[model samples]
Target chain A: MSVNARTMSDDELFYGHKACPGCGGALVVRQALKVLGKDAVAALPAGCMSATGFNFPQLAFANNAMITPFAATASVLSGIEAGLRAQGIKPDGCTVVGFAGDGGTADIGLQALSGAIDRNDDVLYFCYDNEAYMNTGIQRSSETPFGASTTTTPAGPSHPGCVTGKKDLFAMVAAQGIPYAATASIGYPNDLLKKVEKARDIRGTRFIHVMAPCPVGWGFPSSDTIALGKGIVDCGLWYLAEYEDGRFTLNRDPGRFASVADHLRSQSRYRALTDADIVTIEAHRDQVWQRLRQRCSCESS
Target chain B: MLEVIWHARGGQGAFTAARVLGAAASADPDTFALAFPTFGPERRGAPMRAYTKIAARPIGDRSASRRAAIVVYLDDTLFADGWEDELAEGGVVLLNSKVAHPDARVVTVDGSGLAADILGRAIPNTVFLGAIAALCDAVTLENVEEGIRATMPAKLHERNIAVVRAAYDLVAGRARADALPCCSEAAPIEGASGEKEREASSVVSAEPPARIIPQLQELTVAPERFARSTCFQGGHLVSKNAGWRSLRPLVDQQACTGCFNCYLLCPDGTIYKQPGAGSSSTVAIDYDFCKGCGICAKACPAHCIAMVEEGGGRDEALHIRQ
Candidate 1:
């Protein structure tokens, strides 16, 4: 695939807001806001972004920003767009975006998000996946990857990190047969921005799953957030892909994928994995990405 | 018996000040003071009230103060909301102000200025207690200092002691100045541009503020008591979120792979991805929520993203991502 297109355009997000040092979720929200621009109204659930960005006393959005319930992010976003439509405001004039962390998207917000997708609601749903319940002190979420340690899934002699792998969130969303569904990473803003622009333009349940590396939750050096995001793709643990019009496209093909161990080296969360475990994880990664590639190819053909 | 009411935004130490006042009053075997806060959100700048009751004997009545012997305004802006009606007819008002109110009984002190200069931030609660100690003969300065010292950390005792002394001297000086007929009206407050800077700096200056104060709207007349709050917004905050940051993340396209990793990895979702040519598109960062965690710089396998010291120097670690 081609790389490093052009510089991103300026938008409404400004400085002087709060996020932790090296927050990947903040980057995802910022870029999404810019792509959506002044016309966008975002409904965010209780998550890291809500705690940091939509803080008390002030909010970061220049546009309307609503704080919805933990499980109602997608539902509230759908309601906001529906309310606007009921008031005779064209959907095109105002973009409704639902933002939630992995904990919200994969766990608590599943039913609401599923319902929104089922209804084919005209809204852009962005899930900035940090892989755990970061806002509530690094607890394990449904999206927490296997061989990673969280507060709830603490690595110990008997238990080695999370026993279960991450929920296949994109597949779940795409299975809904939405108009647009894609996977993105904060490490590559241009690609993520392109996906967002494409999703919002396509209309009807656009779900973009973004990989936001959390320094605090992921147990990595704050500065290594972007690198870890790329590491997951390079290791075949994660793949960048898009699902549109029932067709699949592999966004980033790692000709020679880095070993899963290489990806794990940077994250302390994965420190519990033994050499044998890494081998098992690598095999799992290959099997998953290989199937994903086959599905993309079959759909494209 | 003495009834004192404190008017403050939350987090400015009004509750703590009232607690300390009560604690100090309790120290005297002859008096007892009951201090508690009203039902208010824990937001930083939302209008909050705390009451302190000191009596020669233990009082049984536990109602809110209808008439106050002394009203302490932790912020001058609260004056705009009107505190004159909360006081007893002969009550005196102690305020954190550079200029005096229209009334002769109104006493002013630059608590924020003193707090910033002394305590290194704006916390006028302790300063107000010191002023009350000076105005009221009931509590000794030693007792007030003891209360402040006991309530605060040992390290803060030195600065808080300095704050109390400074406030004591300030009100004493102002009292002497105002006693003169020529000085009937207090000299006009100076350089009032920073009045917003007076309280605890939580969250102030909302971007594209729709209303100066949030509109308190009722969705239904007969909603549940808990459901009465229709908005998710917290109380007013004077603290700026920006001051929490130390570094910022920036991107370099030359070494970029357009993999969309950083766009997805941002914890705050501040990265914007715009589709251009499918392979190589454009992306932007929203600094408002960036928080400079540099997850992008770390996540970029292409080494295209870098972290720079926020409002500081060029970080040698920031190489050209290309």
Candidate 2:
């Protein structure tokens, strides 16, 4: 069945845990699990989802789930898949999946993820990027965007928030010629669900980097999580794209990008972003999109 | 020694208040105090406890206080029956509530309202510090001011000091007027059993102690439980999350288009599709697990879901609307 809003199963696989109200990471896990079904053996590293989901005596995952080492989310998924295959107990339609945060994936877990892709392990890896090390009180990560305020990269009169641009994780992964990879966000649930379902069917290594906004760390009202998720994409700060079989596709090409300043001002994390910083961000975005339009098959509105 | 317990939701600054109170008491040259918080790795809005102990000499034990001379409730929704049990002999429960309880042991204070008026936000933690200043002999308002200076940043001190003074005056005036019931004249909780019926409309568990003890027991199971650490029961819930919500979403089913936008977007997955007449379906919220993020209400394309203040705590609504 097509995983859309109306046809989506009502059965909740991720519930009863203590995630913050309007947690985008929690939504990413819940929606992805729904598509993967009960048969999916899940692994999560030390991030917001794992910390909030795996409280003793109050385990949130209805399906089989375990916490992986901080930097070993992908490696652990490979191990789980191999172990299940060796035991001949791997259920049909069972997809070995890993949910790691931005730091876990882009920074620490990048090596293991690269290894998994190299070996072409039959696993689905999800990097729920909240843009920083949110679980550990909003520290800077490789995936943390330029001019975003984090504990390590404090914004001040003299110092701009994060001095570096967001790492090109999709390009990094796609460079390996991985079987399937997609970029998703909590804002577009339908698109996210579709991508998750598609990756579930793929046999070899699959990765979906989902933009999950953290309301507490991001300095927005909890209710704005979905809005911010959508805003980030609509504002052209984040993109919707996929990589499959040496082919790159741009799912969304918002020809006229929304006000990047408005989006930045909505989040206090970008409160210190000067006009120059915004112009710099826009320039970087244009540069990246220019490259994407050149190389990828762009979808015309 | 004066031991105090603070019951609050996560991110509510209970620990900060506790530390400030401790700092206030320790301002005396001979006095020593310690403050700390205890909670699982639960995120914001989860219920947690903070403790403060003050004594004349150096304290030896660093364990959590089982009983306290004062038990302060930062959120009145956290108040449950048998709250009196946590109190030491002649100790009172300082509750941040506008609703007056008939029990003399429970002294209700509109801390959220007072703080919201002054600070433009409902931060009741420091308000309780002011009440502690007026009611307890251990710390005076001057000491509380010193505590605020020591604990909070310079920009925050002026306003927080104002809040602390306001709370002190409220409690002090009531005490002087002989309107505030003395804890020594404690009366049994008049509606202890009757309150159960009222609790259903809200998330406050009618019998929290009953559920809490067993959960604690499960945590400390001996190593010889014969099995691995894996929990077989999927979606095991230790407690209902109704207490987390300050605002509740009320859905008008007639206007609902079954869009599933609210259901699909809810982070907690608390919104469920209830099959309606024929093939049509409408979404309903499972308040037991709903963290009251208001996402579902906002996501509702039909504008059917309205975010209303959760039932009870009418006073909190007044300040919130302000």
Candidate 3:
């Protein structure tokens, strides 16, 4: 391993994993392992990462990995932390990370995750948001954005795809008043690593929401995995911001925002969008941006 | 280079067929291949699609296949539901049905029932792979056999091989003599020739009109009302209202174990378990909500689920995998 590689340690923490080519979820775990190092113990749920990380004897990780229920990853991590503390095993340099998808975070696992955050548990909670429940097939979840098509909410003559907007998860997590909560994306690996490293030192609950792109689910080329993340942020559909004890900070300066049409056109899920639909999406985007701007301005002063 | 589209129900071996075909193409030094599924949360018996592209060059436009040189209908019932629309003019259609059809050059085989009979399970994907090899001549039986061995477990390898052989023999006997004469004796050459051929074909064919309608009035009202209905009354309701537009999965109670696995795993939450007096009860899948991802059958430990044909459910349990 090179100097940077050594820092990101290639030791199979999850071990013997099986992920598709250009899987963004797998990349998130890989990058997280690099920052947390070998001492980290990840509690994964029954998602793509979990399936890929625990393939029989061919485990994918070099550190400790435990598979947990879909909606109980946070609870499992809390138990693991308590168990280690009981054994007088101070996780001095070790970190406990709870990994789950958007469905496990914003929907099913939200209660347990909120409880963990409310108690200020000394753990890192990472929700790799691929928009929908990708592992189970492209179905609309709470995190699924408006106007996007999924297997369940298909865009047709009458139906206009997912009419409901994505649940405000970052706001919900921020409301917990955790020590640190930030939004990251696989597109910016260095920034993602920086947040992970920062979260490693924090004693209280540190939440990092990563926007991971799914090629199969999103109807994009597998090669565009990294680009989609960037596109999401660039389109202002997903804003990169952080909260430290209710103090919000905008990470990426909102430059000249691109049209939502440009972003929607790049994805197959949005292929059915009409001009009127595009206009509707643009209006929604502006409203969201305005709200985010107000929040950022309020925090800065 | 051949662009192949697979039409099968969720539990059938459409995805496996695509993978096997792609793998076989990969094994040949002269060919490049790509395979992917149009991801859906479809359950067993729900119509699903998977695609494969074999070329002599690196593949481009890696998206859902719009037109295909070879259309493999794992279930024959899909024919009535516009399977022909996706097929290229003069394309070969390899079917797994017992009844011979005259619309396109059809190579039919009972791969699903055969697999269930021989393997004590319903997995006909391997059988379809054999049929594809004989009908399209894009990949060889040996290549498909190797792909199966590489993908399947050691214990199940022999069974899959047997299934493949049976399918290959059936298709070989039924394949049209002049269907693909150039492919009969040719060794696979890895190059872009196949992709070029497909691109040329796509260009030659009139481009499909943009799905967007400029005028709302021009938008034709869809005859099917299956998606709009809130509840289904009975079996007749499936045929009456949803039959024309929607594809439904028909479960056989004898083969079903009433396992809640399907209920838990359905992404759309379409599978519902009704309150029963005892543990042994039937699980109902709400067709209104089911997207038909087929992860249920993939997750089924008992291997009892089979995708039924769309519109009509008369030809139930036409197994796609052995």
Candidate 4:
């Protein structure tokens, strides 16, 4: 049975500007803009999204777009909402989105974001988590998973790649008691679009964390970006899950997970990983699954 | 057709100079010019660079500025750090310096002092523009003046024109030198065979660290004036209401070579230097205390003094307005 495609909107929320070929963030943004339509006002930070979305006077977005500093997306969106309310010029059914990178969201903007969500601000916070800071020449961020090599955290004789585990932002946002929080991926465009549509209707903070692959930062061919994104899920390294009102749900499950080596072999970021490192990563994945299962049970109980 | 590399600190008018030069070149159809900055997050008081390419034919390589026919040092102190090496052999070097150069052909002007005299503040970019026009004869003083007017505000246009005239006259009457013989092309340095073999072996044998340690150093913090709890003072947070309040503009008169790098890199257009100011034509930052992003220090060629924390101040949080 053929599934019906969602009715696409003519309004370009993100104007067509140049990004690196096969940029996962760019593709995710395109899908997001498609879902958001004309009534949306995007507050982008100093990341790939901002650079690619606006090119001086000729912006890719058809609606109002504001490029903000790296870690101020939430504050900007809050101010925008307050301004509209103060002017008695309510946006015509507008969806206010604060888009940022993982570094901006999970690390730097976490406080402001937490405050905004706690205040129950009417904004959708989308974290396009490419793991590291790709714009600043591939620096390691808190969201960067263990074993991933960034420029600052190179696998040299003195040090390995990123030492820290990925920040559990979904749980952190859920802890704030915000209305909705979900993890999406570029590999699943339809699912991502649906989540965005759902979040648009919600009044309070709705968080969507998407795993976007960076070809330049991740040291992978542009053609392999999508494949690597999908491979992460297939290897059970990254999972698509959601938390809504204290309830946890795993959106997609891999019955039998592929080897961690399969995922690592595809990206250059993990080129330095040895056999022992692969085993350790596999064990970490198993532990994550256990935690996820426990959370799922707790939610039901 | 001449290519020029303008070196200045962030907040200097290096980019502005490049843009103005490009604009002047655009006025002449025979000359094709393109100006752009090297992409990075270089902030005020940091070393920043800009390139302007003017060619009789359409420029092929649209990348970083590798070869420059003319090297304009808005701040002369930048020259102490091998800034002259960027200049093509026999290319003109217009510097904002007090110490005269007798060895190589150099045009010296106190642009910062001239700008301060004209505009009541030290901004030497217009002066450098005039010097560039006079030295290269690539664009006329009229074109440079027009470009300045087009680039600057209406209120400051007249003063900028005055500064430009001062610089033009300073360099125009100087004796022109014949182009120096080009240097012999240096042979490519070959990699050591043993070193190359060792590098290959290391790559293959390298193992990921058993335990990765995350560096948890405090990242660069913004200045106190900009540091606010919420970016919600005015109805619109995007407005530059409190943006320029607590800037601590620093000018190292002893070190400033006055190349105008800072003036060009400033996104807010808030930097200016004066040639022949006080003791020297030193580069001066307008916003005394910058947001402390360090783009200027990184861009400064002179290894001059940088903006540091004045004292204990609350780190300002940047609030973005949607």
RMSD of 1: 18.5
- Candidate 2 regions with alpha-carbon error over 4 angstroms: B1-232, B277-279, B312-322
Candidate 1 on A8-71: residue-level lDDT in tens? 4344352234567777787777777666666788888998777865553344565677789999
lDDT of 3 by residue, A1-301 (tens): 2223214442323322355544567667766765676678789898888776554333455567778998898899888888888998855788999889998899989998999988888889999998898888888899899888999999876667999998888889888788899898877666687788888888988899998888788887654676677788887888888888678888885567766788889899988778898888778888987888778744322
In order, candidate lDDTs are 0.73, 0.85, 0.70, 0.67
Task: Please state the error at residue A142 of candidate 3 in Å.
Answer: 0.4
Indicate the TM-score of model 2.
0.63
RMSD for all candidates, in order, please: 18.5, 21.7, 27.3, 26.4
lDDT of 4 by residue, A1-301 (tens): 2111224442323433445544667656656765675567779888887886554333455556788877789999899888888998767778888889998998889888998998999999999989999877789988898888998888854455887899999989988788999998866655677788888777888999998888778887654555677788888888888888778888877778977897887788888888788898889999998888777633221
**True-vs-predicted CA distance for residue B204, candidate 2, Å:** 28
Second chain alone, TM-score for each candidate:
0.53, 0.55, 0.55, 0.52
lDDT of 1 by residue, B111-167 (tens): 888888988998888898778776665566788888877787888888888888888
Candidate 4 per-residue lDDT, tens place, B1-322, comes to 3677887777668888899888887676545578887636857867777888765434545677766767777777676656556777676677777667875657677877887788787767778888877766567888887777777678877877888887778777764633222211110111133245447548843973332211111322233212212221111111111232332334456666765544322322224445655565555553421333333443456756354344423222111100
The fnat scores of all predictions, in order, read 0.37, 0.67, 0.00, 0.00
Candidate with the larger TM-score of 2 and 3: 2
Better of 1 and 2 by lDDT: 2
Off by over 4 Å in 4: A1-6, A157-159, A297-301, B1-322
